[model samples]
Target: MTAMRSPFRDALTTALLLTAAVAIVAAIGTQLSGGTQRIIIDAMIKMIIVLGMYIFVGNSGLLSFGHIGFLGLGAYTAAWLTIPPSIKASLMPGLPDFLATAALHPLPAALAGGAAASLAALLVGIPLTRLAGVAASIGTFAMLVVFYAIFSNWTSVTGGQGSLYGLPVFTSLPVAAGFTVATILGAAMYQASASGFRLRGSREDAVAAQASGIDIRRERLIAFVISAFFVGVAGALYAHFLQVVVAREFYLKLTFITVAMLVIGGMRSLSGAVAGTAFVAFLSEVLRQAERGIDLGVVSIGGRLGLQEVGLAIAMLIVLIFRPRGITGGRELTLGWRSR
Candidate 1:
């Protein structure tokens, strides 16, 4: 007799596959050079961020260009909580009394950062979520611009354009892999939940969903907050991973790469998010290595400037042209023996 298929079963299968793949990569990355390990960390971080994105964009069928703003908020909030009081005083003397004096552990700081981003999302989503289609996308983009402008000029708090340093480097490959696994599980559970299904239904047809009594705004806002919490956690991890924070790191270039990852991986599925992240990460690492010079005894490739961006853009264009739904074609990964 065959066991009955359920959302939990499907989620478990997908989560296990994603976790296993990342764990394997982590094990292999441990044997590689420091530079290569850094690449792996970068990839895992992108996985976290993209999965957070999948929670929102994948289920809602909405494109958000401003989620990076939440990422920045989380990073800075975590930085404020974790940096030493003395360093904080020097860099951001204008911090509130509590923030200026309170130096917390990484775990607390990460939690606080996630909470901060979720709060920001709630406030922003209230109005932005009310809009739909291009207008909604523009509203979110505007929010990102607002975040950038504020962080860029808020020298007393954000250090303006300067890099904020002295953060503890605690995000090892294993640590990142652990987070990636958790993120994968969380994304899968959410995607299989009733809320996720309703949001997707609304995405399919707003009018029909509304006629069915589904509150689109509420669903979108819920997703927005949940996604922000994870993205914010990714930011905290990123801050500790790099031991630095800069407003610019959460800006346009980062946004483009992350969004591209989602689009290329198949924004509709959790597997797509993971695959896209790994694919783009591998391509990016190779391109960067080539830019440094890849020697092949007889001849060498790379040592060229600006090739990484050019290569990535070309690859993305090719994928879009040929596989517009992305590498996974918007389908979830499943074991052949498992029930669909």
Candidate 2:
């Protein structure tokens, strides 16, 4: 007898369950989940981060060690736009005199911020996408460093090492959850699209793609621009969620964590995105919890195990030892299961 082909059935259940769980949590934040609600909110934020990683690393088959820079750009852009003129005058004493006099709403500012970072990505992607493999990787890393340097020195706009606050908390649990669901669904849909197929084909074999009349550079540019747009949106989400923007938020460490999520999640598959994002987001929270302190009958460790370091080390070790291909191993969880 032929065994049933229900491989994705189980996975689809898991994805649906995850989405349902998020929806419930988002709907009942603070009302339930008690003190853990903030943690759930943060997990949703990380989901956005992982989704950003999925576009470039998953679809394009390129390792971009620098997309986090878009986060910083978006953060500052939104922060600048949301900040009241009176507040801006105080913290950012030297903000462009024009900006000090300008008035903008938070929602429009979010869009503007996203567009700003996407434009930057387009400019950067135009040349960088031409390089493939590890070379492209290096180029993205350079972009991150360049972005970081600018944010650090461009105090007039970014507030430098200082914090830029005053953003209204327009983004909350439900909004974030809605976006997480959308990004996951969108990324999965993108993978199955004709354009995504062409991009994947180019990533797999540029020479072959060129022989088949595919423009390798154009594909890369397209993927890069698209990736940048989402990343920027993710940044705006982050900015609104935090209600503050700072330079240190998307430093090299966050970049490493983002890369780790992609590598572990299976950069080539949508299942990998969901699995990797959920795993990393939830695990990081657990680490945070354990770091705060685990109670024991006899004695409590008092939570101070330096959870950040421990979490990263353990995450890397787990990915390397148990499953080098990351979660889902590049397989996607989709509606295909229903038809099959």
Candidate 3:
């Protein structure tokens, strides 16, 4: 007979395994060219974002399309703090004196970005968390739209549809991998926490959860804020990686891809989040290469534009058709052993 593992231990094991997997990928990327390394870094960043979504969407069983808005908020915040004051003055002339002149290190600026997103989540979640089902999803989408509109039109702070350049490029493969590991561990820990369980209970059966004295709304709000923080951090990393920030990049296209990654991986499981991201990232890369044309020795075959999106959509449909609970069937990855 085997002793049952504690939830904390299980969560730790899962996080460690996932971190090891990410490390392996990062190691392989180092052997490849710089472009490939960038792709790996970008994928790890996306993993962080997906894990953030998993924390809220997986635990609360709520679908949110607005999480990327928090990413945008984080990116802009990092830009505000880290960009040279001289650049800020010319690019964003309407900025307040403090932000205009203040330049910070990338690490703290990333944390500040997370904090900014967390605050935004807290403010929006107050009322939004009260809604459930499709209503809540729509509300989140509306929030995304609102964020995009504000970021696009707010010329002073966000640069108003213009790309914010001159950001110090500090996101390397190791940096992204480290953050990815931290995010995976954080997500696993959160899923094992009391708040996480309560929120999941509400997701499974709201009435029963509420009857058991669970404050569903409050739990949801907590998850929302926490998830936003992780995504915001990813946003800061993205800003540093690209050395540029564009409002449009944080809008609908990103919202769709991130949500799709979560859904395809098994939104209810941490392992699924990791797996889905890896699978989709690989698939997207393949499709992108094919779009650039594949040489078949005798004849070259090329794919049209939008191949990546189309391929992802088809892949998602096939996965949903066969595995309705996502590729992991809503199960965490674990050693194949039974506890007694």
TM-score of each: 0.95, 0.88, 0.97
Runs in model 1 deviating more than 4 A are 1-5, 337-340
Sorted on TM-score, highest at the top, how do the candidates line up?
Answer: 3, 1, 2
For 125-150, candidate 3 gives per-residue lDDT tens digits of 99999899999999999999999999
Cα lDDT of model 2 overall?
0.75
lDDT (CA) for every model shown? Answer: 0.89, 0.75, 0.91
lDDT by residue for model 2 over 49-100, one digit each (tens)? 7776677677788888888998788778777777888999988877787777
* Model 3 per-residue lDDT at 215: 96
Q: Which candidate is the best by TM-score?
A: 3
Question: Of the candidates numbered 2 and 3, which has the greater lDDT value?
Answer: 3
TM-score (C-alpha) between model 3 and the true structure:
0.97
Candidate 3's C-alpha runs over 4 A off are: 1-5, 337-340
What is the total number of backbone clashes in candidate 1? 0
lDDT: which is higher, 1 or 2? 1
Residue 337, model 1: lDDT of: 37
